[model samples]
Target: MLTFKVLAALLDYPNAETVAAIPEMRAILKAEGVDAPVLLLERLERGDLLDCQAEWVDLFDRTRAGSLHLFEHVHGDSRDRGQAMVDLAGLYGRHGLTVQASELPDYLPAFLEFLSLLPEAEARNLLGEAVHVVEALAERVGRRNAEYGLLLAIVAGLAEGPAKPVRLATGDMDEDIDAAWAEAEVRFGAGAALSGC
Candidate 1:
């Protein structure tokens, strides 16, 4: 059985006051003949539960390379589950993106669209705060043009409802858009551009 202390620590519970409350956790680990507490501590020390800090570093690098498509997928799927939005925002912050109230209107759509994938209650709780930060960032960056504008519009539509129509460009603008975004990333930083979305 897993030790209550181990499970509590893994879950970041306030305190593993007693081992009795986590009987099921203990039983499951015990049944598996696992030394739950030791394993948990080892994983924690090794940052395994943190899912490889280097992975996140690689993710950040890919994001800078403009190759990280997971965020786009997550943004697409975030209908009400705010966790994805929160995670993305945290990543942005970690990468030194400045999220502020002024930037909210521009970036809020994307943030909200992500939150939308979460439960309504979670979305409701997260939307306001997330929007506030996004707005602040937008204000810092000023207004958006075609590329950023379109991205924001897409995010906004998704947040408001599913299957919202978006008018994205087709054909030859891909290279131009990529170049523009890359230049912007170099100038403003990837986190800022992402938050601007």
Candidate 2:
């Protein structure tokens, strides 16, 4: 659904087009039964984008609190995380979905795109597997009153079952971002590869 695309776009770095996209996103969310936030559109309409973009970077790009990467929340930098990435990317490939080199299969946005390709029941079941991560992210981002939090909540709502949270270790506060960036890329079967953060 276009709502998945819109939600995915909301996680990306903001630009002029992002502000212009607000109405379409809000309308699509409404049509999809998501009670979209009006405050976000109001801020964008008032051209408070500088502040919004700054908050986006501070909340997501800088901190691990709302990382869009699913494995980062579930597995950290452990060896298991690498294996999970490979497995997930392979799952996408097996289903004939070609993930871009720049996007991780476990990335929530990419995952949402994959969900859009699945039948409703399958999509809901798959989403249920990661509902905890979405719920935790929603809670964290909602505390800051970020509109992006609503997207997470909407995703969590789509999945079946209780909103149980997955326990995770605190990430290394002193960890190097560039170093983390240099970690091995996730390689799917048949020579596909994606270098994602």
Candidate 3:
């Protein structure tokens, strides 16, 4: 599904390749009834490639609130998270999706790519696994007043079940982005390690 590809592109680090592909992706997403992503597409469209790349790094790479890796939201870098990664990678292999080492299996772009390989029902089923995480991230990104949150909401919308219950209090997470920027750059891990994860 091109909508999946569009989501993947938006979640990836934006660059000349990503910027150049925006128009066609926009058309595809619109045809797929995905209007929410257009907000992000518009941001990219208005900027030149460099500006878009900067925005991507600012919004995603630099902040936990807008992190693109799905597991970072839930698992962090705990052994559990690593195991989940291994299992997810195995699942992808079963489906014929090979992920490179540099790209974590839980990365949203890669996850969306995996979804693109499945039937809609199966895709929705798989997406349901991260509905709560997506919901929380959507709320966080929305608080930033960046329309990119809508893309996360769109991911949650793809799930089939009722909204998943979340124990984490996302309402009090006002400093997540600021806090993320303060910490040294650490990669994924559970608990406190998540700030950099």
Q: Tell me, by TM-score, which candidate is best.
A: 3
Sort the predicted structures by TM-score, highest score first.
3, 2, 1
lDDT of 3: 0.75
Which pairs clash (backbone N, Cα, C closer than 3 Å) in model 2? none
Off by over 4 Å in 3: 168-197
RMSD of each: 16.5, 9.4, 6.9
Which tens-of-lDDT digit does each residue in 1-197 have in candidate 2? 56666766676667789788888888898897776666666766675678878977766766566677888887878899989999998889889988798877888878987887787688778889989888877877777666777767877888877756567544433245434544465677753643342
Off by over 4 Å in 2: 171-197
Per-model TM-score on C-alpha atoms: 0.22, 0.77, 0.82
C-alpha lDDT of residue 175 in model 3: 72
Each candidate: what lDDT? Answer: 0.36, 0.75, 0.75
* TM-score computed on alpha carbons, candidate 2: 0.77
Model 3 scores a TM of 0.82
In model 1, what is the error at residue 81, expressed in angstroms? 26
